[model samples]
Target: KKNMVKTGKAALLLWCQKRTEGYKGVQVTNFTKSWKDGLAFAALYHSFYPDEIPFNSLSSKSSAEILEMCFACGLRHGIPRLLDVEDIVEMPSPEPFSMMTYLSQCYHTMEGGQKGRSGLASIQVNESQQRQQPA
Candidate 1:
């Protein structure tokens, strides 16, 4: 269950990078080759499928234990530059932007956020103010 999130995230980032970033929505030349290579990871990442299987060995483990193992397996390591994995890997902070949110924020949004960080959300000069004149 936990690993599925990791799988989806990697696939999603790879999806985003291949589909959204530098290539301009086009698949890279080696995409199919990489996808084919990805299939061989089915055992360690086997839980990443729509299908389910019981693991007698893991039945006794806690979810945290399973998640720890997933991290150790490097299941969630390859991250887009938007997410600072080191900053987030520790734990809960007052951040509205969690790791997933950070991932989704992407390049353009980061630029916008940096602008907003200076504190003005958006200052819309009203028509009346526009009409009043620029002094």
Candidate 2:
């Protein structure tokens, strides 16, 4: 099960990298000191907010408009968290999400799609009402 989960994450990250070609503001190469980390960051944000990252969908958009959207995404969530947690000088270090909990949450929600399952995503949410049982 662990191996399967890792494989799924790897596949997702690869797909994320491919999708980032449309982003002009952050040149995937020059934008981040670590390419893999940068790509993974972009992918996670993209997965959570697909509508925010449009491809050739907006032909009428000016360069400045596209840049604003990309910048908003890059600075808004995971990236800032990543910077706060990791030593930025070290490229490709594993820092998970800026808030590590979100990574697991995202994986749980999206992992179903990786197994040829259509939109049946699972969420590992812990309700406050459900208290832990003492052993």
Candidate 3:
């Protein structure tokens, strides 16, 4: 999870360097510094909000835009997504979203379409939900 966030930040930093610095007609040193600063900012953000692994759909958007969004959210008592617990602990945990979760979603849906289960519920519904009380 951390790795994913780090990688995404690195990618965003590179994108920022390629776009803003090149467009501003800034000096090479200044451009280079901005690029490096962007990277530093990204690294700092990931270090803190390392869990909000770039939402797949968000990643589909422009990297610069995504970076901007993250930067915005990082401030102002943002979502503490790292811990995966929105309630208990105050500080956010640095855990990324599970890729397997999305993969499983796609896998199940694809498989479901192929095999039309002759039932309504995807999982067993009438099964025991609690421990049996013994006499």
Leading candidate by lDDT: 2
TM-score, cand. 2:
0.31
Q: Sort the candidates on lDDT, descending order.
A: 2, 1, 3
Residue pair clashes in candidate 1: none
Model 3 per-residue lDDT at 21 = 41
Of 2 and 3, which scores higher on lDDT?
2
Off by over 4 Å in 3: 1-33, 36-40, 53-63, 78-135
Identify the candidate with maximal TM-score.
Answer: 2
50-95 per-residue lDDT for model 2 (tens digits): 7776643545655344434544665554333233323432435434
| Candidate 3, 1-135: lDDT as tens digits | 986545443433333333234222222222123322223233333433456523433435543454455445443333222212221112232122332232223223323534523211222221222224344
The 10 consecutive residues of candidate 1 with the worst lDDT sum are 34-43
TM-score of 1: 0.23
Winner on lDDT (1 vs 2): 2
Give the per-residue Cα lDDT of candidate 1 at 101. Answer: 47
Please state the error at residue 48 of candidate 2 in Å.
Answer: 9.3
| Global CA lDDT computed for model 3 | 0.33
Off by over 4 Å in 1: 1-44, 47-56, 75-135
lDDT of 2 at 68: 45
